[model samples]
Target: MHIAEGYLPPLHAVAWTAASAPFVVHGVRVLTREVREHPESTLLLGASGAFTFVLSALKIPSVTGSCSHPTGTGLGAILFRPPVMAVLGTITLLFQALLLAHGGLTTLGANVFSMAVVGPWVGYGLYRLVRRLGLPLMVAVFAGAFAADLSTYCVTSVQLALAFPDPGSGVPGALAKFGGIFAVTQIPLAVSEGLLTVLVMRLLSQSSAGELIRLGVFARGNARQDGQQGDEQGQDRQRKRVA
Candidate 1:
């Protein structure tokens, strides 16, 4: 669900922009490091951005008179890393705003904070947690997707509430209204995202995509190797520069 421009008050927009600045900065730093350490990651990040843009543009009408689309962050996080997913998400949002008018330019930062930042981080964290608990791949995927979708909605609702805090409405009322309205569409959306993510992960696991393995996008322990390689490469670069 893209929050259109002017939907949020100026104060709310300013606050969200301020809050999201650090995330954007951190994401850029992480991406830059990844790119420097593993040049091939740049291609994967571009692919993630293209995939996310397409997914977000394909929308279906939901209960709130607004259309909903897949976030695609789960897929990126499953394939790349969460921080990289944030960059992909930012690109996707920018394209959506420029081409499709799905989201507004003024509110791009806020929307990115909710969908790209909050959604992927929550989903990736849940995936890690469920996998750690020794759950099935499908279960982990479902949990991650569901949590991601729900968290995005929750964040959007809070943003809205902050912008338009009804004098007569309490937190419960806001929650009910936002939760109820979103749950109708988001539940099914989450299920769809979960299935898609699981299928993609399964395919990648079976394929000979060494890049995916190197990125730690599918296999659980593979990420350690990726990180180790990154670290070693960084050290080698430093040594060469010193020499």
Candidate 2:
């Protein structure tokens, strides 16, 4: 959810910015180290950022000052970890603010805190938890992606409720209203995003098997299987070329 510019009160905006700045700074450092140490990972990093940008840019009218959409943070968080996602999410929000006007500069911090910070961490946490519980890889991926999308909306609802509390009923009342409104669209959207993320991960497992293994997405046994499959495909291609 992109909170429109100037929608949050001035004091609230400043507080959010302060809250988000440290995370963003830490993310930058982590990203730089990743690229410098593993130059080949650059392409995947770009792809992750693009994935978040494209998916999050698609917004549907939901709440008064915000809209509901897929966070697309889970994939990156799973691939590169949550610290890297904080940076990617911030960059995604910044560009969307400047070009699409989907979110505003004044409210960028609040938006980033919700979609970039809390969402990725929650998703990554669930992913690890499920994987630890002996679930399948794709199952864990779906759970993580679903959690990420839903959590973003939950945080946004809290942010909105806090900023513009109901005059009569106060913060709790405002929270119920915003949370209810968001749940209608957000739940289905989270499910769709989860499935889509699983599909993408499957494709990556096929095409970028080595990279996935290095990133710890695939195990050594899977790597051996992938290597054997690669050898077969290479032999087939050579035979065709000779013919």
* Top candidate when judged by TM-score against the true structure: 2
Error of 1 at 176 (Å): 2.3
Clashes of 1: 0
lDDT of residue 134 for candidate 1: 81
Could you give candidate 2's per-residue lDDT for residues 91-166 as a string of tens digits?
8999999888888999999999998899899999999999899888889999999999889899999999999899
lDDT of 1 by residue, 53-77 (tens): 7766666555456656777777666
Model 2 scores worst on lDDT over the 10 consecutive residues at 223-232
Per-model TM-score on C-alpha atoms: 0.81, 0.84
Candidate 2: lDDT of 162?
96
Candidate 2 residues lying further than 4 Å off, grouped into runs, are 38-44, 57-69, 221-243
Pairs that collide, model 1: none
lDDT scores in order: 0.72, 0.83
Clashing pairs in 2: none
**Candidate 1 RMSD to the correct structure:** 9.1
